[model samples]
Target chain A: MKYLNKSWIRKSSLFILSMILVSPLFAWAANAVDYSEPLENAAHQIGAIGEGYSLFSGIFPEYSLPGTNIVLDTAVAGFFGVLVTFGLAWSIGRIIKKGNE
Target chain B: MHIPDGYLDLWLCGIFYLLTLIVLSYSGYKARENLDEKKVPLIGVVAAAIFAAQMLNWPIPGGTSAHFVGGALAAILLGPYVGVLSMASVVTVQALMFGDGGILALGANIWNMALIDVFVGYLIFRLFKNKNKSIAAFLAGWIAITAASLFVGIQTGLSTIFKFQLQTTLLIMVIGHGVLGIIEGAITASAYRYLIDVRPDFFEKSNKKEVEA
Candidate 1:
C-alpha cells in the first residue's frame, strides 16, 4: 500500500463520518413524521431490477407527452455551451501563458 | 429530485433561486481566477461528455432509470468551483431548453445538486487524497455523491414539510436518491479512473498551479 498521508486521510475520513452522521439528524429534524415509505418502495423496485433501465422509464413517464424535442434541444444546447466555454477558457489560458513566457 | 413546476411554494423557490445565483456566481469568479486557456477547451469538452453521458440513462430496477449526476465526478476531476459551474451550466441549459426542471426552482436545484454535490463533494474527496489514488478517488467519488443524493432527499423533505406532505416527499427523495447514489458512485469511480489514465495531466495538482501562474 502507498504510504498514505496520515493527517490528510484522518481529516478526510473524519469529515465524511461527520457528514454521514449529521445528515440523518438534519433529515430527522427537518421532518416531524416518518417519511421513509415512498423511498423504501422506490428502493424495493430498484433493488429488484437494476438501476440503468429503471431510471429511464421512471423519470420520463410514457403517459407524459413525448417531449423528445425538448430533450434533444436541451442536450444540443448543453453540448455547445460546454464546448464554447471550454474553448474560450483554454484559449485565454494559452494567451496568458504566452504573454508570461 | 428535479422538482417540477408548481410543486413547491413560489416564495421558497424564489428564495432558493436567488441563493443559487449568488453561489454560482461566486463559484464562477473562483473558477476564473485559476482558469488557464489550455484548460478551457478541455473543460468544455468534458462538460459535453458529461451532458452526453447524462442523456444515456440506463434503466434502474424499480420501474425507474438512473444516469450519472456527474457533479461529484466533475468536482473530483476538476475542482469544486469549476465542477459546480459546469453542472450549473448543464442544469441551466436543461431548464431553459428542455424544461426538465422548474424555472423558478432553478435556484434550489442548483444549490442542492450542483453546489452541494460539487463543492462539498470535492472538498470531501480532497480530504481523502492520501496518495492511495485509486481508493481515495473511489471513496471521494462515491461518498460525495451519496452525500449529495441525501441532500436532494432532504430538500424534498423540506419542500413537503412546508406542504404538510413531508413524509411522502422525504421518503421519495431519500429512497430514490439513495439508489441513485450507488449508480453515481460507480460511474464516478470508473470515470475518474478513465480520465486519470487517459489524461494524467488533467488530474495533476500541478495543473492548478500552472493555471494560476
Candidate 2:
C-alpha cells in the first residue's frame, strides 16, 4: 500500500507538472472580451449561410434570409452538425461490427 | 472557447491546423490499433452528445454562462484514444456544420479541447482510478478544462494580430476558467459515478475487448 501510494503520488505530480508547463498555451474564457470578437463577426459575415463552407457551421445559417435570425441559424447549424456526425458514425459502426461478426 | 475566424493571424491558423492535423492523425492511428468494432458507434454518439451539450449554456456567476465541453467526461468514460477521436469528430462537425468555431481557429480549438483536455483527463484517471475513482475523475476534469483555458489564453495573448495584453487576458482566462473548472470537475465525477452504476461493462476492461481500459 505504501509503495502504491508513492507511485500514484509520483505519477500525479508528474502529470500536474506537465500541465503547468503547458499552461501558457491556453486560458479558457467563459465570456471573453478580446481582440478576437470583431474578427469573429467578420468571419461570420464571410461565412454567411449562402456562402461556401468556410468554417462557420455548414450552410444551415441564413443570416440574410427574409425572416431568419443569427441565433436560430446557429442552432440550426448545430442540429445539422450533430445529425451528420451521428449518421456517419452509426453507418461506419455497423459496417465494422458486421465485418467482425 | 471557440475563436471565430479572422481572430488569429491566418499564418498562425495555418500553423495550428498543421499541428492539429498531425496530432489527429496520430490519434486515428492509435484508435485503429486499439479499438474494437463494438465500440465504434458509441464514439459517434459520444461526439454527438458533446456537440449538443456545448450548445446548452447555463448562466454562471458574473454574467457568464458555462456549458459542458464533455472532453473530460468522454475521456473518463471512453479512454484516451476514443475520447480524442470523439472530441475531434465533435470539433470538426462544430466547425464544418455549425460554425461554432472559426474555420481557421478550428485547429486551435481542437488542440486545446480535443487533444490536450482529453489526453490529460484520460491519463490522470487511468493513473489514479484504482485508489480513488472520484478524485481521479474530479482532478482529471479540473485539470483538463483549466489546461484548455490556459492554452487558449496563451495563444490569444501572445498573438500579434490581437492587440490585447497577454497578462490581462491570460489572468482573466485562467481565473475565469478556474472557477468553471470546478463545475466541470463536479459534472465529470458525478457523471462517472452514474455511468458506472448504469453501465459497469463499459469500465470492465477485462470483459470488453473494445474498451480502452
Candidate 3:
C-alpha cells in the first residue's frame, strides 16, 4: 500500500511539473507577441475581423483596459480559458456517462 | 488556424455548420457507447491542457503565427470520438470567451481543428503505430494539421469574401502549416513519450490497441 501511494504521488508530481513547465510558455508569448497581428495579416482586410467583437475584447491589444497590460490580460484569459474548457468538457462527459448508465 | 467571420461566406458557414453538427452528433453517440467513467476527467484535463497550450504562439516567417494544436495528442490519449468532444470544447471556449475565432466561423473552425485534426491524426497514428510509436505520433501531428489546412484552403478559396485564389490559399495554408507542423510533430511525440513513460497503464486502459503497441 505504501509503495502504491508513493507511485501515485510521484506520478502526480511529474504531471504537475510538466504543467508548470508548459505554463511559462504562455507568459513568454503574452509578453513577446501580439497574437492577432499574424492572423490579421494572413486574412487580409477582406476577412480579418480586427477585434470588433468578443466577450473578452478588452483583454486583447486592440481594446485593452486602461490600466491593464496585454500580459496580464493574456494570463487572465488563459486562466479562465482552462477553467471554462474543463467545466464544459466535464459537463459533456458527465452527461454522456449518465446517459450511458 | 481559426477562421474569422468575414473570411467565409454565410453559405459556406452554413454548410460547414451542418457538417459539424452531423459529425458531432455521431461522435456523441459513439462516446456514450464506448467511453468509460474513469476517462471523463481525462477528457476535461486534456481539453484544459490543450486550451492553455494554444496560447503559446510561435510567430512564423510570413505574416502569421503557429501554435500547438493538440488534436492529435487528444485523439491518441482518448480515442477519436471522445477526442472530438474534447477538442470541440476547447474550440467553443476560445470562440465564446476569448474571441479567438470569429462567431460566424465557429462551425468551420470546429470542423478544421476539432473534427479533421482529431480524426485524421487518429487514423495516421493507428496506421503507423506498428512500425514505431513515436514516429507514428510525429506523423499524426504533422499530417493532421496539413490535412486540416487543405480544408481551410478550400473553404477560403471558395469563399467570395477572400480575394486569394484556390491555388494561392492552398499553397499558403498547406505549405505554411506543413513547415510549422514539424514543431507540432515534435511536441506531440515528446508529450506522448512522456505520458507513456509516466502512466503506461493509462494508455493501455484507454484503448486496447495502445496495449499492443
Pick the winner on TM-score between candidates 1 and 2.
Answer: 2
Give the clash total for candidate 2: 19
For every candidate, the chain B TM-score is 0.87, 0.92, 0.95
Writing each residue's lDDT as its tens digit, candidate 2 over B80-177 gives: 76678778777777666656677788889899889989988877777788799998899889888888888877776776666566775567667867
Model 2 misplacement above 4 A: A1-58, A61-78, A88-101, B61-63, B206-213
lDDT of 2 at B143: 82
Q: What digit string (tens of lDDT, one per residue) describes model 1 on residues B31-93?
A: 666665555544544555565455444444333445566777777766776677667766655
Among all candidates shown, the one with the greatest lDDT: 3
lDDT against true structure, model 2: 0.65
lDDT values for all models: 0.56, 0.65, 0.78
Question: Which stretches of model 1 miss by more than 4 angstroms?
Answer: A1-101, B160-168, B205-213
What is every candidate's C-alpha DockQ against the true complex, given to 2 decimals? Answer: 0.07, 0.15, 0.37
User: In model 1, how large is the Cα lDDT of residue B78?
Assistant: 65
TM-score of each candidate? 0.66, 0.73, 0.86
Candidate 2 accuracy as TM-score: 0.73
Clashes of each: 29, 19, 0
